[model samples]
Target: MKLKLIAPYLTLIFAFLIISCSSDSSNETPVDPKAANNKSLGTAARDFLSAEAFTGLHVEIAYVNGFKPSATTINNLRNFFSARLNKPDGITITETVVPATTVGSLSREEYVKIEKDNRTVFNAGDELAVWIFFADQNSESDEGNSRILGTAYLNTSCIIFEKTLKDFSNRIGGANLTLLESITTQHEFGHLFGLVNLGTAMVTPHEDEQPDDAGVDKLNKHCNQEDCLMYFQTVGNAVGGVMNSLPTFDEFCLADLQANGGK
Candidate 1:
């Protein structure tokens, strides 16, 4: 039987900036306190990491609009996640690749609308899913085009813009697109796991305390560790710096994850 699509009960928004600097801190909008306190985003991370969460978990990676990831790329992501999310009590990670298709051009709002409309394609409570869109996603603001690498809705789904990643890769001597994509995928997932000041309580004060020109907190939801995968300001040449070496969760990040029952 085909699964029915259910609209997301709660949509948690976490935005990532690809540029090294933001427009203005004053423009930074505050997240709703009520939404921040919502248990769905917070508890989802805890439940996924808990030994009793599920006997097995499935992660579906769908490539839309001509986005085709290589076999090596797919395997690398699986290996990276298995080492971290795997459990000793017979928990297993299964991955399936959805065939590539042309979904046509889409703006940021359109992409989001499509995800919400077809939410049933994802197993809702049954699976962890991420959709990678290779098409260009333009912003309505003056930032022009390709300013974000990806964004993840807590426990719901992750949307990645490959066109931007490929553009960045070409600027840097045609670097490995797969590596960049992997870094982005993992970084966004880190947010879902409640890194920094997100849902998970931080163990250390690694949060970026500096404010932007507008006086808004610069590290609202990102790590301050330059070498960690969850670090903010990972765009343009900064991406290469982070990808120069393998990205790993810093001590503070690991502490938070461990505290929440993650490996």
Candidate 2:
């Protein structure tokens, strides 16, 4: 999803309706409820990492019919969150089947419509909710052989191009489907946790430099360590751009998370 296997790196952006739920004294302007569940990416890092604000984590995994992620992947995701998050209350996941998109590829608007219509979980009480959709098609952001696997958009929302991911996983020399799913899921989840200097500031300067679509240098919001899960390896070079095995967060990432209140 990071780079097109051909030449250009497609940038996929999703703009969700923003709502600030925090209420100030009766003196400040009113907050918009319509913006509920939507916040800037990486803004909810502390809430997910630390138990200070949210003591429990609820993940809503909604998928297109017949495209539900494997149980192994789900367990892997749960384990990843449980290992890193300080949510002592508990971490839970709920899966639901949603209608499939009619399109072969999905645009930002299509993504928004689907999520708005089906997503049922949002941050409530002492629990922080995370929403993830498993789409049955490729992202409209795809170009050439570069197919998007997943994208983390709003603070608590992400979508996985499940069909495309499966296709790639079944490819010759591709990584195991479960491993690919687990890694990709964890990677997107890492974004939600604000990895590699995203929302959580880095203890050291380790953000990797990647070129934009125009070949311009930019902080592509990934880790510098190739062995880290957040590293942005070019899919064009790797077979199907999927990892052969699961990867752990590099020490720098661990430091960032710990500094931000994560275990």
Candidate 3:
């Protein structure tokens, strides 16, 4: 089915600036928390790609009661990670079922707190933990026809607007629901890997120029290739002119990952 969208559930990357933590006792900041999993997006690209720092990758899937993703969606994500990451130890994932939420929209700070309260993984020892929250609510940042489907907000954190994506995909008889979920999830992870100059530097300058929005994030973040997985548009993940399955990252995005130590 062709997905007709009024406002496409677009992927958002906040190139969030690394927040400076407060001083400790002797005017020295603590090293652990500063470089912890809560840092800005894409800052830990090498840690995720190469096994130099973190040999094992653990993914924490936390979702609201009614919004847990299907097994197919999770498996697609695993396959996507296996193709790029050099985690010989392996990439593991687990699901956490949280209570259903009532909020109509989620805020950035609210998302951070959700992870902080329930996240059990972190950048510790030899494993780097990633937390993906499947939120039942849309983002408070959504304006009119511009809704955010998934976001790469922090280095190790991502939020998927399950409600928005579900509606966008098949609410009015659109594309396959599973494909949309897989694509949105993988796209968010792309930002975590620093695609398009977010954290992973480009081997060639292929950043897509967006003139529609004036925000800092609307510039220098997405791929110039419209059909690439990291493309700024929602149709980037569609196949054969439809949203049928997840699309692999374009060559340039793949090159960026390799240069940054990915497989």
Best by lDDT: 2
Which segments of model 3 are wrong by more than 4 Å?
1-35, 213-218, 235-241
For each candidate in turn, the TM-score is 0.70, 0.84, 0.83
Clashing pairs in model 1, backbone N/Cα/C closer than 3 A? 5-120, 25-214, 26-214
TM-score of model 3 (CA atoms): 0.83
C-alpha lDDT values of all predictions: 0.52, 0.72, 0.71
Off by over 4 Å in 1: 1-43, 86-108, 117-142, 235-242
| 135: Cα error in model 1, Å | 4.6
lDDT of 2 by residue, 1-263 (tens): 23222322224542221100111112212113435467777788999899999999999999988888899989889889888999999998988788877876887667767878777777788989888888898888775545566777777877877887677667555557777677767887888898767789999999887665589877767788877877775222233443466788989989999999998
RMSD of 1: 10.2
RMSD of each: 10.2, 8.1, 8.0
Residue 210, model 2, lDDT: 62
Whole-structure CA lDDT of model 3: 0.71
Cand. 1 TM to true fold: 0.70
lDDT of 3 by residue, 1-263 (tens): 01112353444532211100110112212224435875766788888899899898999999988788989999988988888999999988978876666566877667666777777777768998998999888877666655567777777877888887776566444567678788778877887888768779999989876454344433547778866877755443341134465677888998999999998
Worst 10 residues of 2 by lDDT: 17-26
